[model samples]
Target: MTAKPPISALTDHLGYWLRLVSNHVSASFARRLEAEGVAVAEWVVLRVLYDVDALAPSKLAARMGMTRGAISKLADKLVAKGLVDRADDLEDGRAHTLELTKAGRALVPRLAKLADANDRAFFAGLTAKEREGLKRLMERTAAQLGLDDIPVS
Candidate 1:
């Protein structure tokens, strides 16, 4: 049999750490969102629509890293729930724009609070400096990945 490659450093590799942290973060957020009667993807769509007055479907799809078809399904669900509305774009008859309805706008702040609470619950033991370090490191990595232009607001 051929000699097997040795495991150099599986325990503390950067990718391993990233995946572990990300998985925990995502799973925690998913649980938090479930309690609020929303799925993670739905929250992502609502959160993105929270800040803007409205955006074209194409723009929303691009920003959310989802296909237009997927965005449409999400939008449809939101629309059914009376949290969002879609209307034809004034400038482009064939295209549509989406906006959070009054109820949706109202729901966003509560969801934001849920998000904050989830973060606090997950990182309460960490010192402020550690949190800041993580934020800075994440920001630097995002910048390095040329993802700084995506507005989180």
Candidate 2:
């Protein structure tokens, strides 16, 4: 087997570059969401529910690549904030599903716009074609890495 590179050698590692860029992007977005009284994960949950009327907590957990317990906890917080409702499934009262509240629904568009502006601010120098190409390549890489099933939200 080949020897692993030293930590100092990470400057030339693609993974290092990916992680650095990811950290900066996530941190910047998190800061922007803070002013709106939301956390990054919370915003992700809200955005997911914004497009769908109702979805099982398990489904959400799978889509978010999180645990059921985590989804339950977040759901509780969202319920407490009046941002989401958790109710027994009509077809199967034993099961539960989540739905966004009116306030949550209203915030979806605003949050989306915030995300768009953030992207523009970060990549303003890149042309639209460049942005599209980046997205296409990223998607292709993700698929090749067996991540095509992952939810965008």
Candidate 3:
């Protein structure tokens, strides 16, 4: 008779622990954003646009590691929400650019504050040094995995 391998418990994996914390942190942030009438994905786009006056949708897609179609859908929602503006590219009539509206510019800081608070709430147990170390480890792991995508969900 062949011997059978032992099964491992879910808690035996690092990803399980990471996911447990990530899910709670992400959900809390999402709920905080809901009061401001923005989804996690929308908040990500708004935050990105906040750093620049405008960007081409294609460029934005490349930076975000998302498909142009996905970006277009998100942009459409932002436009409808009056948080973003899509304008004809001044130099290229055939192309368009995406920029945050005045409302969006004003809202970015508020949303950022919420993000900060959510992070603190979840990570408060870690000391400053421990938090820094944890961050370094996560970044290193992501680099090892060749992950450059800005996580929105």
Candidate 4:
């Protein structure tokens, strides 16, 4: 019988390296968000809602590449926290539009600052050029993969 080839080490794959970095970055950001009394998913939703007057739940779900049910759940949490408001769509009574409350609007910038700080904290080892190159490479990879989803988790 022929002997099987040995399995590769965990670090042998590019995905493994990427995941290691991603896990650390995401966990750090999650902690930062928690300190602000928000979840990563909630932050994604709020960031999207920050610039808009109001947007339909269905549209938001599509834009975020999430299911309507998932969007609804997130929205429910935000609404409960008094950070978002849900009102009946003017043109479609059956549908609802979501908008940030005044408090939510106020919190978005602060959260954005935290996001910036978290990124700097993790990536500060890289030079500015290296950081830009890494970001460009990641964006190119995502575009190549046709990945448009707003990563919530």
Clash counts for the predictions, in order? 0, 0, 0, 0
- Model 4 clashing residue pairs (backbone): none
Worst-scoring 10-residue span by lDDT in model 3: 57-66
In model 2, how many backbone clashes occur?
0
lDDT of 3 by residue, 43-102 (tens): 999998999889998988887888999999999999999999999998998899999999
Candidate 2 regions with alpha-carbon error over 4 angstroms: 1-8, 148-153
Comparing 1 and 4 on lDDT, the stronger one: 4
Off by over 4 Å in 1: 148-153
Model 4 TM-score is 0.94
lDDT (C-alpha) at residue 70 in model 4: 94
Q: Provide C-alpha RMSD values for all models, in order.
A: 2.6, 3.8, 1.9, 1.6
Q: How many backbone clashes does candidate 3 have?
A: 0
Query: Clashing pairs in model 2?
Result: none
lDDT of 4 by residue, 14-102 (tens): 99999999999999999999998999989988998998879999989998888999999999999999999999988877999999999
After superposition, candidate 3 runs with Cα above 4 Å error: 1-5
- Who is ahead in lDDT, 2 or 3? 3
For residue 90, what is the lDDT in candidate 3? 84
Q: Per lDDT, what order, best first?
A: 3, 4, 2, 1
Judged by lDDT against the true structure, how good is candidate 4? 0.93
Clashing pairs in 3: none
